[model samples]
Target: MRRHILPPVTRPILLLFALAALAGCGPTAEPAKAAADEHGAAVDEFERGPHRGRLLRSGDFSVEVSIFEEGVPPEFHVYAYRKDKPVNPRELTLTMELTRLDGRVDRFSFAPQGEFLRGAGEVREPHSFDVKVRALEGGRAHQWAYAAYEGRTTITSEAARAGGVTVETAGSIVMAELVDMAGRIEITPEGQADVRAWYPGRVMALNAELGQTVRKGQVLARVESSHSLQTYSIPAPLSGVVIAKNSNVGDVAGGEALFVIADPTKLHAEFFVYPRDAERVRAGQRVEVRTLSGDNRVVAPVEAIVPTADIASQTLMAHVHLPPGASATFRPGMGVEGSFQVAAWPTALAVRTKALQRFRDFTVVFARVGNTYEVRMLELGRQTPEWTEVLGGLEPGTQYVTDGAFLIRADIEKSGASHDH
Candidate 1:
């Protein structure tokens, strides 16, 4: 009975004390909770200065950009701004680009730069954006967005370009190549029936006309001399079409050709070369001839190049041998072009004809630097339809555009870029 009576006062006092302690704890936590809620809240505010990046001339041929943040992470976000213009989603290629910069390099890629190179084109951008900086080291991250001044952030890269012809090269170069040449059939200088007339002084008559067909030893006309009254008919020297006939029946005959018939079976090409090219010319050299008729390219071997040059033309004549029974399409006096292999250069650096751009005295090419194109001046030597021998100005292992050189030039010109081409 005594314990029960004393516990009553203590129990009531303990309950009151507990209630007061709980009330104090509730208010104390309110300030801390309010601070935490405000700490991570989204804010609407503005900042001054160039907190964003704007890409300028991307080196000589492309565009690159950098933000004002030190120790930027590998996975930083990039925002593009274009003075309120919407961005082009198709042109963006961050996923396809090949990253080459080492970890130490501040440069980073955000688009698929390689796919654009599949065609002949180029890319130029002006936009502003916001991005998140993903920390790769410890997974720490931060986010930011910039309005980017009226014109901020630009990226330039190379794209595939279409090919175009160089008009100036047409007239300066041989319009076409000639591969074969042959002489017309020949006959006696006079219309003589005599089986044998070896002397230079012989008068002859003729009955054949230009383009007339004649047979070997067939009497075409008669030959008469002042000493004798024997009239002999001039026979066809060989079976061929008469290409040229200088005399007709009853005409006074001189040692000059009365009828020139070429042996169709025996054909050869004769080309004239300048004195400089004649030095490199030799008998038995391989040559390619392009006939003016129907783009004919005939390959033949050089037979002879006379040591003498034509006094009037100042040209060295070279005879080229052809295959027997050639197509009749090739005729005498047809213009043809020829090519000769001068020498070989082992390990010679070369590129396709389309890869070159002709300047005043030098040649230029677009050299790939990273994802951009750089103008490279090249020293050129011998050239062919398919390739050009590079004497200098390009590396052996580098890749270059072969088919779309003109498109690249067009892009550079359109952009008002400084280039040698």
Candidate 2:
């Protein structure tokens, strides 16, 4: 029995080993490695493919791009021709398309020209035109549209890509906005208020502290007639608060104020204006007064503009009327500082104060188009304390930097930080 059991167990074990060995020798493959290799080939082909662009239509004018190698800007320059005569100045339009990775396409167009090119010479002169572009992030097809002025008629057309460019530099590039240039005026006063003894009276009943409200004709203190010749009651002429008391109870009549009363509503400010600005400081111009005490800004109308200027100071004094609402809370001696709305260009373009930048030579501002920032040259006009008048280079509806403008300027000054306009 032991011999038969041993043979059966040994034979079964031998058969199992033989089957496993045969299975191990069967077919096997590196599937993952093969897949990876195929993906690499696909990527290479995508990167090496050609990008094609064509000028679908062009005005009698043409533009050449030289600054940016491929994706960079400062690229397009335009030239005009009249007939075949090379008109001293020609008007033009164009269209262009960009084809990017993954078969994506982009298109762009140019704004109409308002002015003819000055001093146009024959033989294709060099000029730059700023066109609006739509980005095709990763595609091969894009379209451009432009307009050309050829005397009577305008020409519109599309341009295609001549080549594709790849950038080797690696880093981050972002477009940022910048502040406009501005001017500010700071002044120190040289005039003082005149203080005099108001009246000499007898002490009456006391009714107020240093800052207490007293109505006009209100009896602050009553005095029994010390002089029989003057047997009339004395009353306050102005409604104000008592600031000082010279005499106490039961004192003899002295020629001093028993209670000092001042009218807070009668506050006045004298602002000096240059002779050039004097013409604008008429009797009815609007004025704005600003004080550092909270947000207590006062807007008032000009009451009068004194024609005579202080000869020594070479400045004219302009007196503005404050509103009763403002005068109620204001004190006479409180200092007020701000600008006068002398001459207003009602149709002028303006931006907020915080939008300006103080540059060494000329003021600079960034014009925002979609997500891109464009450098702008500005000619500034008369400026109010809160807003600056834009003389040139910017459109009215454009959004500009109001706060954190310096940060935008810093970003722009950095190399490769701004997009070409």
Name the best candidate (by TM-score).
Answer: 2
In candidate 2 the C-alpha lDDT for residue 264 amounts to: 52
lDDT of 2: 0.39
C-alpha RMSD by candidate, in order: 25.6, 23.3
Report residue 183 deviation for candidate 1 (angstroms).
Answer: 14
The lDDT for every candidate, in the order shown, is 0.43, 0.39
- lDDT (Cα, tens digit) per residue for candidate 1, span 99-202: 21111112234542331212112211111122212111112122222221111111133123112211111112222222233232212222222223333224
lDDT of 2 by residue, 1-421 (tens): 0111111110011000000111111122111111212212111111010111111112222222222224532233232322323322223343333332112344434333332221121111111122222212122222233211000110111100111101111112221121111111111121111112233444545555666777776655555565443433556666766666666666755555666666555555556777666555577666667553435667666666678878897777777666556665554655666456555545347666446774334465554433333344567766655566677755566655454445444433432221211
Candidate 2 runs further than 4 Å off: 1-210, 226-233, 254-256, 272-280, 292-296, 306-316, 325-330, 352-364, 369-372, 376-393, 413-421
Runs off by more than 4 Å, candidate 1 = 1-135, 139-209, 217-235, 244-259, 264-267, 290-297, 309-315, 322-330, 334-337, 346-349, 357-386, 389-404, 411-421
RMSD (CA, angstroms), candidate 2: 23.3
TM-score of each: 0.42, 0.47
Model 1 clash count equals 43
**Candidate 2 has what TM-score?**
0.47
